[model samples]
Structures are given as C-alpha cells and as structure tokens.
Target: MDIHTLDLNFLTDEAIASFVVESSDGPVLVETGPHSTLKNLERGLSDLGYGLEDIKHVLLTHIHFDHAGAAWALAQKGAKVYVHPFGYKHLLAPSKLYNSAKRIYGDQMERLWGLMEGIAEENLISVEDGTEIIVGDATFIGWHTPGHASHHIAWQLGDLVFAGDVAGCKIKQGPVVPPCPPPDINIEDWHASIDRILGLKPSRILLTHFGEVSEVETHFNELKEILQDWAAWMKVPFEQGRDPRDVTPEFQAYANGQLKAKGLSEKEVARYDAANPAWMSVAGLMRYWKKKLGA
Candidate 1:
C-alpha cells in the first residue's frame, strides 16, 4: 500500500492530506483539501503517475470544506465518494453546509474554499461504524469517530489508521492541538473516540493536518492532555459569565503561551499557527460548552 501526502496550500502552509493505498486497481484518495487547491491536488496525483480517473474510491474523514471539498470534482470523474452517514445528505446538497460556513467565513468563504458544488447521489456512498469497505486490494474499516464533528469517521487500513481530527492537530514542534469545530464538539465523546482508536493499536497514525506519526502511544497521550486543557479552559470563561467573543482571544493567548512553554522555536511556532489557527478551535470549544450546558 502506497501512501502519498498531498500538501494543499490552503490559506496556511502544511494543510496536507494523505492519499493512501494506491495500486493498479486504483488509488484511495483521502482528504481532498479544498476546492481552490484542486490543481495542487491534481499535480500531486500526477507526480505519483496517476490522475483523477485512477482514483476509484475517495474516503473522506469528514465533510469539512478543507478536507473533503475536492471530492465533488473526483465524483465527476466517476470515483465513488465514501463519507459518514450523517454527512451524506449534506454532500448531496451543500446548501446548508455553504450557508453555515458563510456565517463563519463570510467574505472569505469564496477565497478560502473556492466553489463547492454538490456531489451526485449516484457517486455518493455512506458508511457507519464497523463497516468495512474494500477498494481494489485494500480494505478500509470505518469507525464512527465523533468529537471533532458528529459526522467524522476514522478509517483503518492495515496497521495504519487514517485519523482525521480524531487524533487532534499535531504540527511539527507544537503541542498536539484539538480541533473542536462547532455544531458538534463533545468532550466526552472525543475522549471515547481516542480510546477507541488506541484500542486498535495501529502501527502508525496518518494525521490529516500533516504526515505520519509513529509515536502512537505518546501522540495519543499528548492529544488527550491538550483536549482536556482546551475544554477545561473554555469552560471557565463560560462559568464566569464571560462573552464567547471575549473568551476566544483569551483562549488564543493561553494556547500560544502553552506552545511557547513546549519549547517550539519561532519557525516551528509559525508552522503551528499557519497549520491550525487558535480561533477556529476556540469557536468550536465555545460551541461545545454551550451545548453541554444548554446555554
């Protein structure tokens, strides 16, 4: 099984994806970056001696624009796109997804995501937990891993697990950061998902934010700690009657300080900042807290 990392130069650098298990039958493209970086994705595939036509199955960790936006393009090439069942309808008709994103991104939506057209129903496939999908010679086991989003899935191929945001965001030199995106960020569920992935005992974890991480135990431990920290910090502001908007900057500052304490150099810290922005997680964390407390 061949795994290729396609670095989709989104707004920031290092927002890469892993195209794993490529063979004559066809290559499985995981995480299609954003619609704006389709050219970069195509170039990456071409560099590997394949094209959109060679991708028979596109496995999405989640349906976030940055991760699964270009899957629509691949679907046009007759590739079967597989995503979580909860996210299936949204992909078929991205109006709600686009409108929700527009609320957060506003004017930057087009610039950041380009155009996200709906994927044809015929080319769309949905899988729940414990569902095994065979694409060519490779077999991927899907686990309904939520926490990052209610519609997230973590695919296991052989001893390697394609952990989307379930493992959190770990960039070089920075501490493992949790991406608790809004609408469905459950702290308890996130912790359970981590345990579920760990139980699989995969040899390597292919993180969507960057490359492969072999330090499975240490990596999971770090992610668990950071997730708790972020959740705990976000809860305090809410309990103290602080505005969500005001708490965002505080969370950013706290996260930056934590990164600095982890001994990330200026250059390494810059990469972390570029790869995973603190505001995005802040919004998610705030949203999670609100839902948990019924605020």
Candidate 2:
C-alpha cells in the first residue's frame, strides 16, 4: 500500500498523478498522465522498481484526457482499467472524445496532449458508488462524485480519499483554484460532492493535480469559498449581457490578483498558470451560468 506521486512534466511543473498501493497482487496504478507522457510514466515505473506488467489494475478518477489518456497504454500491458460507468463507453471508443478535443485544441492538439488511443473492452471495468474493489488485500471503495465532470469518481483507500477534482485544484505553491472546464460546471453539485468527500472523514485528501493535502477541513473550506466567489463574480458579467469571450481576460486578471494576495510569488504564479489556464475556467463558468439561465 504505497502511494507514489508521478510528477508529469507536461505543460506545467505541478502536473502529477498518484500511483497507489503496490504489493504482491500487483500495484494499482491510479490516474495515468496524458498520452504524451507515456515515456515518462514508463521511466517512472522502472525507477520505482515496477514495470507496466507489475500493474494489475489501472484505476481512473475520470475519462478526461489529462487524467486517463494513458489508460489505453496500461491496458495494453494487461492492466484492468476501472472507471465510472458513464465514462466506460468513451474509453472503449475514444474517436468522439478525440475529435471533440481536436475541435477545441486545433493545431495545438499534438503539442498539448499527444496521441490518445482507445481502450479495449476486454480490459474495461465500469464501477459505481459503494463498489469495493480488492487489489491484493487492500479494498478501495468507489464514490460517484461528479461536479468537476459527469464521469468523475473518487476512490476511498483506507482513510485517504483520492480526490480527482472534486476538492478543486490545489497547485503547488499557489492559491487553491478550481478546474471548471466547460459543458459541465454545476456549482450546487460541486459543493454537494465536496460535502460527500468531507463526510468520509478521510485523514488526508490526495489530489491528482499535485500532492497530498492533510489539512482536509481547511483545504475544502477554502476551495468552497473561492469556488463560490468565482461563480458569483462570473454571474454579474453574464447577467449584464457581457460577451463570454470578453470576460475571460477579466477573469484571468481577477484570478491572478487573488493568487498574488494568497502569497504566491511571480514564479509560483507562473507554475499555477501552466497547471491551469485560468481563461478556461472563465469560459466554463460562463457556459454553466448560461445553461442555468436557459433552464
């Protein structure tokens, strides 16, 4: 039951994935970094005295490319990939996902994410809440905690919960930020998911964006506060008929100022920016607000 943080030198310094529980029954590799980082992942496993074959289970918190893009590679190595039921079909057939991403990323696709292949159905395992999976002697309880994404899952191992993005984004040496990607950013559901994780009384919350955070109580509170503030701020501009594209810069400026006030140095703030493009959140929140208004 060892937890290894694999720092993915992607577009940012704090980008990381947690590989948890290595033993005789074989290690459970959690959250494979994006497809472009396969070499780094292989080297990381080798350095840790474990090869791809040593991994029997690849548990994904979600099907987002940054989080589960490498699941196909791991499945190729015989690892049984487990994910939320909603994301099962996407992994088995990623053509739609890839094409959608391509539309958003355009020419930057390859440079930003590299190639994402489809996972075989034979290696796919769809899980739901309360489903306890036993790898070796350790039991991991899955919780269908959405908000960050509809396909999100949070795994409870012992007293620590591997919170993919339910707890928000906590970049190393930066203000605790939220990754609110578009097409799905429900503030109410996000808060509910936060409460769900807190109720577990986990001693520590492990974030896929970076490292382990033991100040669960304080961390979650701060995350909730900032998330609400961001949402509220976005509402005014949205209701006033401001253009979504025009508001992105304002959002980034606000976020940058907030990060500075939180004691992040210029270099640290750059790290945060690299980890999370602030403008993306602005677009996401705006979209969420528009959807709510329409409903």
Candidate 3:
C-alpha cells in the first residue's frame, strides 16, 4: 500500500495531516482532518490524481473532530467510515460531539473545525478492537488504544501504525508530547497502550499531528517519558487544589521550554501548540487525577 501524507495546514504547516493509502479498489483515506481543511484535503487528493468521489473507505484512528471531523463529508459521498465502537454513536449523531466542542472553542468553532454533520448509520462502521477491515488489497487492523481518549484506535497497516494521538504529537524533530484532552485521559491506560504498540514492532509510525516517524523505538521512548513527565508534573498542581487555569500557563511554559531545549524554533513550538494545546492537557490530566484520587 502506497501512503501519501496530506498536510491539512491547520494553524500552521505540519501541525495536522491526513493519510491517503493507495489500494487496488481505490484510495483509502485514513483521516479526513477537520472540515475546516476539507479544501486542503481535496487539493492534496487532486494532486495525487484522486478526488473526493474516489474515496470509498475512510479509517479513523479516533473520532476527535481534528482527526475525523470531515469524515461525514466523505460518508455523504458514499464512503464508509471505519471507527472505534465507542465513537460510533457520535458519528451517527454528531450534535453531542459538536456541542461539546463548541463549549470549548466558542466563536472559533467554524474557523477551527468548520461544520460537523451526522453520518448515516449505513455509512458508519464500528470496528471492534483487533478487528481487521480490508480495503481493496490493503488490510488495516484496528487496535483499541485508549488513554488519550476512550475511543482511540491505533490502525496497524502492514508494518506501520496510524497511531493518531495515542502515540503523542511529534512534529519534525520536536519531543513527543501526549495530547491529553478532557473526558478521557488515563495515564496508566496510555502507558499500557504504548507497551502494546511496542509489541507490534512497527517499522514506522504515522502521527496525525504531523508526518512519518522512522525511528519507531526512539520516538515511542520519548513519548513514554514525556507522557509520564507531564502526568506527574500535573499531579503536583492538582494535589494542591490549584485551579487548572493557574496551572495551564505553568505547564505551557514547561512544555515550551522542553521544546526550546531541543533546538526547536519559536515557529516550531507554535506548531506543536496548534496540534496539541497545553491547556487541554492540563484539564485532561487533572481530570484523570481527580477520578483516580476521588478528589
């Protein structure tokens, strides 16, 4: 299977990407990105000699709007969207999902993610953990990898894994920072998912936040380290009963500092922020601690 990375150009270049896999039947899309970048997705496909109509199979690693927001558009065009069972209902009835995000993004919803519409039940296909879905001659096995989100899946295709946000966001050469959005952020589960991914021994991992990472072992190593580091760091503030708003900026500075230490430019740091916001992680990890500690 030939895979092409389409840059959604969200907020900044290389911040978000959608993968197109060439198959015997047609081009299978891995992620449609948000509807805000649908035009970019179209142009990228067009350059690859494909079109919106040419896409018949869309494999979503998760149902996060940034990853699968434009999926409804493809489903409307007769494409089947494959997603985790937990995220199935949301796609079939996206109002809840849209409203939840609207609460967070407010007036910037349209600019950040465009519009979201419900997918017909017929077009929504929920794949259980370890379920294999074949598109043309290419085969994709969905692994239920939660931690970042309860509905997350890591799509294993051949020797590479479309790790979505489960593997964290690593842009260019920046350090891997896990995206711990609210509603679902369990550090223990995320660590287990990382171990499970390691067992697969994939040669390459495609991150939705950016592009292809060839050094699989090293990439995951950093991801694990930072994942724990971030979680532990958040514990300090949370245990003190510090307001999340107060902790967010501190965590942001800590994350930004790490990026700078790695020699990333100011622009590079901003791109990382675009792909995964620091404030979200603060909220996510804090929520995780609250649930576990029963605070």
Top model by lDDT, which number?
3
> How big is the RMSD of model 1?
1.4
Candidate 1: regions farther than 4 A off: none
What CA root-mean-square deviation does each model show from the true structure?
1.4, 1.3, 1.0
Q: TM-score of predicted model 2?
A: 0.96
Model 2 lowest lDDT segment of ten = 15-24
Global lDDT scores for all candidate models: 0.84, 0.85, 0.91
Residue 102 in candidate 3 has what lDDT?
98
Q: Model 3, range 1-295, lDDT digits (tens) per residue?
A: 6899999888788878999999998899999999999999999999999889999999998898889999999999999999999999999999999999999999999999999999999999999999999887999999999989999999999999999998888887778888999988998999899888889999999999878988988888888899889888998999999999999889999989999999999988888877778899999999999999978
Deviation (Å) of 118 in candidate 3? 0.6
- Estimate TM-scores for all models: 0.96, 0.96, 0.98
How do the residues 1-295 of candidate 1 rate in per-residue lDDT, one tens digit apiece? 6777877766666666756578557788888888888888888888888888888789999999878988899999988999999999999999999899989889988888878889999999999798999877888999999889999999999899999989888875456888777878998998899999999999999888877899988998988988998898888877777777777767777888888888987777667766667777777887888888867
Question: Which residue pairs of candidate 2 clash?
Answer: none
Q: Residue 268 of model 2: what lDDT?
A: 78
Give per-candidate clash totals.
Answer: 0, 0, 0
* TM-score of predicted structure 1: 0.96
